[model samples]
Target: MTGLLAFTVLVALVGLERVAELVVSVRNAAWSKARGGIESGQGHFPFMVVLHTGLLVGALVEAWVRRPDVAPVLAWSMLALVLASQALRWWCIASLGRRWNTRVIVVPGLPPVVSGPYRLVRHPNYVAVVVEGVALPLVHAAWTTALVFTVLNAGLLAVRIRAEDAALETLPRSTEVEHA
Candidate 1:
């Protein structure tokens, strides 16, 4: 298969992985709601959904329509970053377990989780998100998508992270630094 075809397949696989994440998010959301979890950032949820979906669609469209030349070194390096981002994302889900969802929900009285990737950074998932945003498109030389997504996502994340921090604040603080 040609490089473009392979990149398409890769993007399709990532899309499928996104579906899997939604499945988990839905289940976890229900679980959280059952426990009286308060959700913040609802206002931005729709935009987040559109932007993330657009990431996949935009990357594929640019790759096919623009037919950008994919250098082997760049493609391989970006592919590695994409895979690493996925791994980090899943690690976050595993660490948070039922506490993890696409929406920002915090269970009152519960202490912030400081384990796994959270130990290293306050929002490791977002780190994964930023890396994937740039790396995935550049894997196929979809620079426009990469640039657009990064800019839009940065604005979205600024709102999202603030909302998340505010929601997490409802939980009781622990002696350890809060990184959930």
Candidate 2:
């Protein structure tokens, strides 16, 4: 099979993984709502969805239309990063469990999660997101998609993180110390 074909399969797999995430997010959102969760950043949610969907579509379109010659070394390395991002994303989901939602919904009085990947970074999932945003498109030499996604995602994340931080402030402070 051609490299483009392989990359297409990879993108399709990632898209399917996204569908699974939505399933989990919906269920978890219900769980959080049951516990008096308050959602913030609703205004940017539609943009977020469109941007993410565009990532996949743009990558594929660029790969097909541009038909750039894929460098094996870059392809392999980026593929590794893409896989690592997916692993990190799932680790975040596991760490947050039912507390995790695509939307910024925080339950009142519940302490912020400081376990798993959260111990390392306040928003490890976004770390995964940033990495994947660049790496996945590069897997098939779709540099334009990667660049555009990164720029747009950066602006979106700025708004998103601020809203999330504000919402999280509603939660009680954890007494547990974070170890360096």
Candidate 3:
């Protein structure tokens, strides 16, 4: 019963996060549209959302029913990783500023963002996303969450990377042209 309540709370938290993201996405879409931003890969957006929702549900179900026994040390470690992932995700957002969004939008003539986290990896946001997907559930010893989300997210990332790469392919060649 306690586990079920905890899992329910977690689900609520995840739902809140999704709501926040949806709000952000709406604002981002409006901002980009106002600036005549080009949007590609609209097709994959639904799948991404569904998969993330599934990840949270899967974690909750596994933890509540399976009641996985997680050691304190491992739980703490996973918690730390979750925190670190959030930090990295925010870092990516802050670094990208206006360019950072859930959608793949490219503005013509504007150079790709190449500062901060982008300097290290072309897709730091995705890195944070991947880490969080696995770490969050595993914090409760739900390895099921880690495995399911990692595999699901991997497939999503494959589609995302290809779409983003293709979207950015049309940029005018220059000295600062960065490749992922």
Candidate 4:
């Protein structure tokens, strides 16, 4: 029963973290709108929601319901990745400021953000995501979750990255900014 309670609390915390992300997205949208940014990818929004939601459910089911004990080394390693993911996520948020949205919103005249995490990699957030997708499940020895989401996210990322690049290219900021 204690294990169950602990597991439930963890799930709730994860959900809350997602809610916090949504709040950031909302704030970002307001800023983008004020800047006359044109947001696209309406069609992709729902799919992203579904996929992220599934990840939560999948992790709970694999980790809690199934109650698999992960290898100590693997769990520690994944925990490290999860911690790194949090750091990177915040880095992206801070670097992008109000320009970052859950959806693609391109503000004209605002050069594509190229600082902090972006300076190191064009898509550091995605890197965090890919790492977390595998790490979260692996922390509990949920190989099934790791394998499935990794593959699915990979495909989704291809489309997502292309769309984001195309959107960024049109922003006025791109005129003088070079893609790193």
RMSD of each: 2.2, 2.8, 3.5, 3.3
Give one digit per residue, the lDDT tens place, for model 3 in 1-180: 564465467667757866876677677767766777799998999999889888788888788888877777876787778778778877877676666678998777667777777788989889888888888787777787789789988999999999999888865544353322
lDDT string, candidate 2, 1-180, tens digits: 999999999999999999999999999999888988898899999999999999999999999999999889999999999999999999999888888879999888788988998988999999999999999999999999999999999999999999999998888899442321
TM-score of each: 0.96, 0.97, 0.87, 0.89
Give candidate 4 regions above 4 Å deviation: 1-8, 173-180
Candidate 4 lDDT score at position 45 = 76
When sorted by TM-score, best at the front, the candidate numbers are 2, 1, 4, 3
Worst 10 residues of 2 by lDDT: 171-180
- Clash list (residue pairs), candidate 1: none
Residue 127 deviation, candidate 1, in Å?
A: 0.3
lDDT for every model?
Answer: 0.93, 0.94, 0.78, 0.78
Give one clash count per candidate, in the order shown.
0, 0, 0, 0
**Model 1 stretches with alpha carbons more than 4 Å out:** 175-180
Clashes of 3: 0
Please write out the lDDT profile of model 1 over residues 26-109, one tens digit for every residue.
Answer: 999888888888888899999999999999999999999999888899999999999999999999998888889999988777
Using lDDT as the measure, which candidate wins?
2
